[model samples]
Target: LAAGARGLLVAPSWSAPDHPARYEEWVTGLPVPTVLVERLGVPGGPLDEMDRVRSDHAHGVLLAVRHLFGLGHATPLLVARADSPTAQAVRAGYARALDVMGLRAPLPVLDSSSAERHPVLFEETARGLADAVRTGRATAALMHNDEDATWMVRRLAELDVRVPGDLALVTYDDEVAALADTPLTAVAPPKRAVGRRAAELLVERLTTPGAEAEPRVHLDLLPTLRVRASCGPPTSP
Candidate 1:
């Protein structure tokens, strides 16, 4: 209010799993129009009525699982962290996708937390994945984000596990997945679109005289999968 801003596009921090309720309370009381970007509010919660835009991570997980199945692989094992909203979404999405596809998890979801900060955790996670592949427990896997997946690949190579040949891998967040030696297949969220839509929504609310009378909008943009060398070619069936 002091700066004379007409509207606000708020993007809450995703560094932690849970967002502070006080922040939501503050945003709720703001006089100016506000729109959230890439931040999902719990249904029926305090910020439930707020306008927001986020990626449909559940659909992204489904795409990864379905692609692996198309390549003659069983349900892909999930390797993810629980540190952020996106990570949690991917974890839940994997389980839901398995239920939808009527497939059982061959192995428990592996935790790749702190792998970037801890080389030991990274090595351990990579070993677990290699063991799953070598023992015929899993033929495919979906790792969250690009950094951890790339680290896992490097460690797996050391353990004599070959990408695609031994374990067809798909990673979330296409950011650096392409730069990996094997060029990991990844899910690409529409980040720019989310920001653009949030801004547009805020602008509409600020400009439209009767915008408060209109129902709030919640947009879930679907993410696209980028196929690469990691998952190999789809099997001819």
Candidate 2:
């Protein structure tokens, strides 16, 4: 606290197991103002409890899933990080869409990494996914981010499968989606806008220092889906 640091624009990582607790402990008693960019350590709290700006990940996922569904994919699989709040929200959106569309019988989630430490499990998972695509059991798959999407596309290629021909891929996070070999279709979160809004809120809070009564600021930035060649028009069943 001796230095000239005024406030913090915080964005917690998905890797943090105790992100919320860490946030509370780190900023609760601090003398300076703080704002969280995405993912809170606390749950069920109102948006107004803290100064925060985050993307509406679930809605974005919903939009993408619906787009796939419109293309004749009733059973779209989601491959995600599995443990992140963002992933959970995306899963919920996928499930809700399936329910609304009156489709069931497909396992909707694929959370990578297993505790069994058995290579067979991963192998089986890969085989099953490849079979699903080849057999038209799953017409499309949604990856948590660009990296996973790229990895899956390459892996499928090794299986003698071609993306958009055998399977369609949509990914979250446009970060490196375009750089992929297939240039995946992906949800592009407003990263710059979220940061800009957080910075603005931090400045306001720092200047006021709770001098004037004000409502807490929370922003849920909407994301857009970037269509690319990875997604193909579905064939009629």
Candidate 3:
């Protein structure tokens, strides 16, 4: 809508590393001001003038994963799409959290992006969970998002594995699915605040032409954990 009206293009984080390069190409011919939120790296040239706000996605992941580990889940698996910055951040945080707990070296981390390429990714992931258990790789798994966690739950049931009994789960984003099924343990991001701040910054830039302000704006929002039945005492059997 903004682009059509010859207005500013204010968008959220592309999340993927390759997206920004493509986005830059798409807006190359346009004369409108473009603002990107939560970008990972610094921009170049005039595009570098675009405004940004950084959130503490890494800390958020760490907080949630640490909480689960502290609750006695020694081996927790992080489930995410392969090669995604969000996934990388979560994995890094999970590793750091485990280190702080005095745990041993890293455990298994699953990437679902590889599943997207193969026709049997879903089935493969479901089948892989059995191996995860047999190898004692992880007693709990933290998904990149709520959608993946929900899918994992269904797959576990199909495999005759009881949630929290056989495997505990956690996810980012406290979406409807998280609350729908006996309350899913999640790390809730400040989505609404992020939106509001992004809009406010863009609008401010729009109103002030050639204003001398910081080229980069970073904002880190603290994440809160929503504990539910999905995670219980590790010895609850």
Candidate 4:
């Protein structure tokens, strides 16, 4: 350090498709005490030796799936993007949840990113998703993030697919989900807790001397599920 900063809170570019091979080495070799914030370092991997804090996205997926299942929906479809680390985590969690619940998705995981940014792709995905609901292929869906969920809902409405009526919906992020026409139920990740814990970890490492410092810690905060009108009343068997 030229900046004279004693410690660092690092959040790498996890949104990228892949990380460079030597990325871990670089972080480990840093001059100051470092703690990762919602970034790399999968458990049991090399990066697990580092201090980090992140949300338990898999647990979040479980919450969504259980909620849908409790509503009498056999298996809810997944609509997600592969654009971010969070999205990828949610996607993996969804698959794992299906396995744990002994349930299979009625349809394949739909690509929410396919509808992002491009109007044509958005319309196409909407129509496909609507067809799945209309034909009894999928009765409910777990969509990642608020924006894409909102977009899909608007397009689905145009095609005569209604939320909580023809299809139950649970979006991943709670950001603006409550503002949607149907006020979607959503999974709210512990973003604030992640940051706060990360900062505390960094400070802890900074204050503790070489021999006194605690072991490298990886903290995972569980997300909360917010129920709303979008999920509607339970379905009948």
Candidate 3 lDDT over residue span 129-235, tens digit each: 75675566667777777766776676677787767777777787777545545467888777777767877776776687764254655556667788887887565
Candidate 4, superposed: residue stretches over 4 Å from native: 20-22, 114-116, 210-212, 233-237
Measured against the true structure, the TM-scores of the candidates, in listed sequence, are: 0.92, 0.84, 0.77, 0.92
Model 1 per-residue lDDT tens digits across residues 1-237:
798987888877665545645467877888878887777665687688888888999999999999998888877899998788799889989999999999999889888855658778777788889998888888899999799889888788889988877888999989999999999999999888888888888888878899967999999999999999999643333
Ranking of candidates on lDDT, top first: 1, 4, 2, 3
Can you list the residue pairs that collide in candidate 1?
none
Best by lDDT: 1
lDDT (tens digit, per residue) of candidate 4 on 1-237: 687998888877666445623477788788788887877654566677778898999999999999998988869999887778788889889999999999988888877764546777667678879998878888899999898898788888888988988899999979999999889999999999899998888877777677226677878899999999888644453
Clashing pairs in 3: none
Q: What is the C-alpha local distance difference test score of each model?
A: 0.86, 0.74, 0.66, 0.84
> In terms of TM-score, which candidate is strongest?
1
lDDT of 1: 0.86
Candidate 2 residues 173-226, lDDT tens each? 899999998888999988899888888888887786663248776689999999
- TM-score, candidate 1, is 0.92
Query: Clashes in each model (backbone N, CA, C under 3 Å)?
Result: 0, 1, 0, 0
Alpha-carbon error at 144 in model 2, in Å? Answer: 1.0
